[model samples]
Target: MEAFEVIQPGPLTTIQDLGRYGYQQYGVPPSGALDDYAFRTSNLLVGNEEGAASLEITLFGCQLRVLQDTTVAVTGADLAAALNGSPIPGWETVPVRRGDVLSFPRLKSGCRAYLSVVGGINVPMVMGSRATYTKAGIGGLEGRALRKGDILRAAAARPVTGRARVPTAHLPAYDDQVELRVILGPQDDCFTEDGIHTFLQSDYTISIQADRMGYRLEGPRIPHRAKADIISDGIPLGAVQVPGDGRPIVLLADRQTTGGYTKIATVISVDIPDLAQTKPGDRVRFRQVSGDEAVTALREYERKIQTVKNSSA
Candidate 1:
C-alpha cells in the first residue's frame, strides 16, 4: 500500500465514503460524505469505485506529500488546490508523483471539497465503513480529523495507465443561491397556514452555526399552531425541524437518529448535495413537491449519473 503524510491539516479533514447505512437500528446515524454526488464523481474520475473512501476537506484542506505515485481528483468546492506549488484544477484527475506536495487554499465558492485517490484511502473499517463519525469518535485517523505528521495509507496500488479525465460538460456548476425541493412532511399539519406560506416564500440565510449535524437557517420565525412538545420520532436526512424558537434546522449526514421537534418539510435527496455546498450567509429557498415528484427527480438524477459513467466507459 502507498501512503501520504499530512504536513498540516488545514481546518478539518476526514476520510469518508458513500456512508454507513443499515445501522440506524443501532442508533448510529449514516455518517458519510456531505456531498455524495461530488464524492462519487471524484472517485470515478480517479478510476475508483463509487463508494471508495476519499478525503472530505472542509473550508480549507490540508497540506500533504505523496510517498508514491498516485492518481487523484478533487471535486466540490474550489479550494484553490495546488500540487508542488503548481495550480490544480477541480473536476479533472491528475497524476501526483512521489514527494509532490498538495495544498488547498481558502474556499472560493462552496464550503467543502472531496479529494479522491486512485485506489481510495486504506483505513480500518468500523460498522463496515471508512467514514469518520466525529461525534461518536469512530473511523478515520483514529476516529478524528487528520493532523500534522499523520501518514494515511492508500489501498494497494493497481496498475494505472494514466489519469482518468472528466469532460468539462459533465461537471456541475457551483451556485451560491440554491432553491431546494421539499416534500410536505409527517408533521406539516403542526404548522399554521401562514407559517407554511412564509416558509415557502421567504428566503433564508444559512447561519454560521452549522455542521454535519444540521444547517440552521436564519429567516422568518415560523410559529406552530400547537405549542406542545412532540414525542421523539425517527428523523430522516433533510428533515427540517422547527423548534419553539421558530428557526428551521435542516438535518444532514450526522443528524441524530431521532428528533422531537416539529418538521415543516423534508428536503428531497436530489437537492441535498446543493444544500451541502452552501456556506454561511448563502440565500436559499424551498419549493414544495409531492412525494412522487421527489422520487422521480431523484431517479432522474441517478439515471444521469449512470449515463455519464456509461459514456466514459
Candidate 2:
C-alpha cells in the first residue's frame, strides 16, 4: 500500500536496510544505514523487523505527503521533524493520516536520521537486501536518492501501532565531540610507536570529505615507520587507513573491498553508530583498547539493544 509522496527529497535521503552483505568478494560495498542503532530503533518503534527496509535521511530533511494513515518512527539526528506543522516526537511511534505532511525543516543535531514504517518500505530486495547503494545503482527504489513526486509504499498497510518509545536513559547522545574506542590493528606495526601515540592523543576534525564510504580526518600527521602501503588487503568496517599523506580515514559501510594503505587500528563495531551520527567539522578522538575490552563493550551494547527491543514489544 502507498505510504507517502515525496514533496522534497531533502539533501541525500535514500532507502536502506541493514545492508547488502556477503558480496564483498566481488568488490561490492556494504551500503546501508550509517547509524545502525537509530535504524534498528526506528523499525522496532514501528513494530517492524529491525532489518526491514527504511529511509535514511541526511543533513537536511525532506517533505512527504501522507497517502494513507500509517505508523512511523523517526530516530537518529534531531532534524526538527513535524506532522502537518505540529512537532513530531523522536524515538516513538507516531500515527500519521492521509493528506498530512511529514517534514524535517531544521537540523538540530547530528548528521543522519532513520524513518521506518510499520510494514517496512516496499522496495524490491537486491542481493538479499533493499539497501540503496547509489554508487552501484543497485537496490532500493531504482538505487538512488529519493526524488520529488516519488510515492513510497509499504509491504502492508498497518496503521495500528504500539506505543514504542526509547527510554531517555538509553538514548544515544548527539554531540559535536565524541571519543571513539579503537583496537590497534593488523597493521599497527607499520607505524612508528610515536605515530600510534599521535593517533590516540590527537583530536581530528571530520573533513568535508566524510561520507558513508569513510571519514577523512584532518589533524596531526601519523608518522610511518617506513612506507604506508600494503598489498591491498580486505578493508574491514571501521578500518583506520593512513596513506602517505599521513592523515587517517576511518572506513565505514561503503568502504572499498580492499585497500593498500596500512590500517593502524579498527574502531569497534558498536561505536560505528556514534561515529555515523557525527557531522562534518566535528572533532573525533580515538582511545586504544584491548580486544577483550572491545568484546565486552560489544556484548554490553547488544544487551542495551535487547532492552530497547523488549520495551518496544
Candidate 3:
C-alpha cells in the first residue's frame, strides 16, 4: 500500500540505500545515502532489512502525510522532526497512524537526515537498487527529488511485533567541527610536502557548493608538483583530489568513475558518515592513518553495528 504524499519538497530529498555495487563497468557510479551508517541504523530501528530505500533529507523543510499506518525511524541530523504536531525523537522508531502528518522544521545539527520505514519505499529498482541518481535520471520515484503532491508507495511490511531500538551509545554525536580520518592516497607523492602538511594541520571549512558529487573545502590552496595532466584513472569514493586551483575536493557517492586530478588522500569509509553531516562553514580537519589502522577501525565499527543488532534481537 501507499505510505505518504509529499506536501512540501524539502531542500533535497532522495531515495537511497547502501548503493548499487559491481556496476561501474557499465559506467554507473554507486549512488546511495551520503551518511550510510545513519541510513542503515535508521532502517534497522524500523525493522527494515539492511540497504532498504530511505528518504535522505538535506537541511530541512519537508512535509508529508501518511496514507497508511507505518513504523518509521529517523537518524543522523537532528532535524526537529514532528509527527501529527508531536515531536518525535531521533534514533527511535515511532508508529505513524494513517492520516498523520510528518514535518521537519530545520537542521539543528548535521546536514542530512534519514527517514527509514519498516518495509522500504516501493519504487522501481534500476540496476538492482532504488537509489535516486538525479544526474543520470535513474532509480527512485521517477528518478528525481520528491515534489509537492507526489505520492510515494511503500512495500507491505509486517506489523511491528517487537520493539527494535538503536541503543543510545551507538548513536553518533553531532558536532560542528568534525575530524575525519584519511589514508594517504594514490597521488600523495605528487603534492609538495608543505601542501600535504597543510591538509593535515590546517582546518578547512565546508563550502556551500557541496552536493552528491563532491564536497568542496575552502582552505589554503594546495598545489601540485607537476603541471602536466595525468590520464584519468578509476577514482574511489572519498578521494580527496586537489585540482589546478589547489583546493581539496572530497568526492562522494555520485562522483565520476574516474578523474585525472591529483588526489592527496582518501577518507576512510568508517568516517565518511561524519563528513556527510558537515555543513557549509563547518570546520573539519583530516588525520592520516595507515591502511592497517583504517581496516581495524572499519572492523570495529562493523562490530558495533552487529552488537546493536544482536541486542535488538
For all predicted structures, in order, the TM-scores are: 0.96, 0.98, 0.97
Q: List the residue pairs that clash in candidate 2.
A: none
Best by lDDT: 2
Model 2: CA > 4 A from native: none
Q: After superposition, how far is residue 152 of candidate 2 from its true place, in Å?
A: 1.1
Residues 124-239 of candidate 2: C-alpha lDDT, one tens digit per residue: 88888999988888899998899999999998855654688999988999899999999999899999999999999999999999998999999999999999998999999999
Model 1 TM-score (2 dp): 0.96
Q: Global CA lDDT of candidate 1, please?
A: 0.87
lDDT of 3 by residue, 1-313 (tens): 8899999879889999889888987778999999988898888787778689999999899999999887888888998999987899988778889999999987888889999887899899899999999998988889898899998888998866566777877889989899999999788888889989988998999999899999999999887787524688888999998898889999999999888888889999999999999989898899999999999999999987776666552
Report the lDDT tens digits of candidate 1 across residue range 53-152.
Answer: 9999998857999888878889988889999888998877788899999999667888789998878999998989989999998877799989999998
Alpha-carbon error at 294 in model 2, in Å?
A: 1.2
Most accurate candidate by TM-score: 2
Off by over 4 Å in 1: 311-313
Global lDDT of each model? 0.87, 0.91, 0.88
Q: Looking at model 1, which ten-residue stretch has the lowest summed lDDT?
A: 304-313
Residue 106 accuracy (lDDT) in model 1: 69
lDDT of candidate 2 at residue 224, scale 0 to 100:
99
